[model samples]
Target: MTRGPGRWAVLSAFTVLAVVMLLPFVIVALNAVKSPAEYSSGGPLSLPHGLYLDGIVQFWQRVNFGQKLLNSLMISAAVAVLATLLSVLNAYALGIGRVRGRLWILVLFLLANTLPQEALVYPLYYIAKQVGLYDSRLAVVIIFTVIQAAFGTYLLSAVLGDFPKAIMEAAAIDGASRWRILWRVVVPISRPTLTVLMIFFFIWTWNEFFLPLVFLISNDTQTVPVALGVLQGDKMMDATMSSASSLLGIIPAVAFFLIFQRTLTRGVTVGAVK
Candidate 1:
């Protein structure tokens, strides 16, 4: 009887929530092109008079943003690929192999994800120095690969556990080895899920700042987020420049999300229905 009113109510609530979520990005975009004088005179919410790109340009040059961007891309891509592989192997053994203590090991990985990075910094830092990996992008990649793989293993394990026994049986009957089944059968069937995980891993590692900050001390070794933090610490930084830096920092992450949006949607839909 009251369905129409309830429908409108839910729609209205979601509309407001969407705006709240997007307001910051909109404001940043609006100000990214606004001259400082215009920004000061018109305030943040007001429409910009015209495009102003100096701040973004200056910040990019100052930070050698190209190098930092490359560092981030290299590190995030390595972590995504390496972590996904590591997770697949671990999850395959524990989930599909039905190994003893699999449940406990999954639980351990789950718990590991919850442990604060702050708690491990000292040990990680000490180990990096001891291994002569400190302040190197390789060190950051190795560290984040393991950190991200923990979550990946936890997730992929559950997904693979429910994999159809009939299909597995068929593969085994066809004289397929475990290795072939993994590569040819399970992997192809699970490609969408793995793609989704890779996207998440890439974005998660891209936005990571703390460990990158601690480990990547050199300007060339730093990532976008770490570079943004360093720029933000400058006493001479202005609000307009701050907005520019923030916009620059998030553009790659947003681009990646958009590029994989279709795959992400399909993967999620498949996961839900399966």
Candidate 2:
């Protein structure tokens, strides 16, 4: 009986917290549908007279948001795929292979992750310029892939390190090559971790601003975040249009999360249990 009441109390507290956190999003969504005049004159918290698409349409045209969105999607997808693949291979080698100095290598990866992007950005810019990748989408993709791979390697290595070794021995006895065992056995079993890594990579790369802003100098090459910054800076777009653009910018990430919510939840729970 006491446990029941305690559980209810905790749930009630969490419910209130959720509502509080969601209040900003609720406010944004409401204001996004409002007309510019309404947004300027009426209170931000007030409801719109009616649902309107004018703000969204005007924002789309004013900022050339469609091209920016496409750029972000491409860069994010490429980074996620490349980073996840590299992480899986590196983790397998370091964790499951029991490589010499494996601990040292992981420590190096941890150190790499700890290094702030700001510290490396200038050096990276010089390198990209020399390599002829400066101001290119490929430049951002490559940079993020490497950066995200460090963290991904750390996570997947931890999970893979604890994986059952007996399975590896059994597969070896069946005359399986290392690559065969890794691809056929290990990867299949590590889908949850991979899924989690992919989701994180996608979200991080999609939301990235600094690198893209620095590297993507051309207007057409800029990603959504960079474009949004430009849109906010433009005097022509008032509050309503800015709000609409922001709403549009977040839709893809939110939709992606909702679509993969089950996989994400499973991955997190599995990681927790392990």
Off by over 4 Å in 2: 1-3
Name the candidate that leads on lDDT: 1
How many collisions between residues are there in candidate 1? 0
Tens digits of per-residue lDDT, candidate 2, 1-274, equal: 3579889999999999999998988888888999888887887888899998899998888768889989999999999999999999999999888899999999999999999889999999999999999999999999999999999998889989988989989999999999999999999888888988999999999999988999998988999999888767787887777789889987898999999999999998987887
Would you estimate the TM-scores of all the predictions?
0.96, 0.96
Give a tens-digit lDDT track for model 1, residues 40-159: 998989888778999889888888999999999999999999999999999999889999999899999999999999998999999999999999999999999999999999999999
Error of 2 at 55 (Å): 1.4
- lDDT of model number 2: 0.91
Error of 2 at 94 (Å): 0.8
